[model samples]
Target: MPTPTEIRLKRAERLLEVAFDDGSRFRLPAEYLRVESPSAEVQGHGPGQKVLVSGRREVGILRLEPVGHYAIRIAFDDLHDSGIYSWDYLHRLGTEQAERWAAYEQALAEKGLSRDPPRRRGG
Candidate 1:
């Protein structure tokens, strides 16, 4: 069980860099994190209640507000600041990003949604 030693938000790059004590670092995109937020507004109270977040394809982090030493609250450009991202949760996200992303994609496919807008093909 590795623990996060530091978490830094690169607002300019729209990424969150999390470094663990075990010398591993992960850079998570703001849009991905926003869509995968654990807040009730997004995740709801239990399984099968996740709200598909749209219009966040261009969303970015405006700022990172530290909540003491336990967590960091991310303020997004889309005005979603309700979720408090904890260090442990962030670490878990970093570790499970691949699986979580795949799951999100599957869910989106089932619902006929996409992370980004469809591109127009040449005639």
Candidate 2:
């Protein structure tokens, strides 16, 4: 597996820049990470049960906790802190970002969902 060499948290840009030992790097966005979380809350218990998470265009990463020597548990500002992102998974996410993002957008459109949260009634 291609292990991560470094992870730069660009909080202002809401991005996580991860570099793997194989010379591949990915700038994963906070919203993408939150929606593609490996946690059961997002991935579900089995296949064909993946949930379509929306209204997270502004979510941010609160912190990242290392889990053993394999993965890291991400703590999102949305209070979701269960997904354990491994080196392999993160690499795949980075590589498949374009296709996955396209699918996500299509799913959202089919479900009448929006990436941005609902607007507040009051000022």
Candidate 3:
């Protein structure tokens, strides 16, 4: 498996830029990473249990912590921090971004969902 040689967090762009040892580079959007989280809440315990996450268009990473030597534990502004994105998984998400994003959008449209969450009343 190709490991990341560099991982940069582009705060202004809300992107995670990863450069692998294989000379492959990917700029993964915050929304994409949030929706495609590898947590049980998102991925579930078995196949076909994948949950389609919505209302995260403006989500941003709060921080990213290294999980051992294999993965990254991302804390998103939405308070979601369960997913542990591994090297291979991250790479796959980057490479298949287009198809996955299109599928996500289609699913949301079918479910009458929106990327931006509903506005809340005065607290």
- Model 1 Cα lDDT, one tens digit per residue, 1-123: 666787777877889999988888999999889998878899899988989885567789988888887778888888899888877888889889999888878888888887774666998
What is the C-alpha lDDT profile of model 2 across 1-123, one tens digit per residue? 999999888889998999999999999999999999999999999998899999999999999889999989999998999999998999999999999999999999999999998898988
lDDT of 3 by residue, 76-105 (tens): 999999999999999999889999999999
The prediction achieving the highest lDDT against the true structure is: 2
lDDT of each: 0.84, 0.95, 0.94
Off by over 4 Å in 2: none
Q: List the candidate 3 regions with Cα displacement exceeding 4 Å.
A: none
Q: Which residue pairs come into collision in candidate 2?
A: none
TM-scores, all candidates, are 0.85, 0.97, 0.96
- Model 2 RMSD, rounded to 1 decimal: 0.8
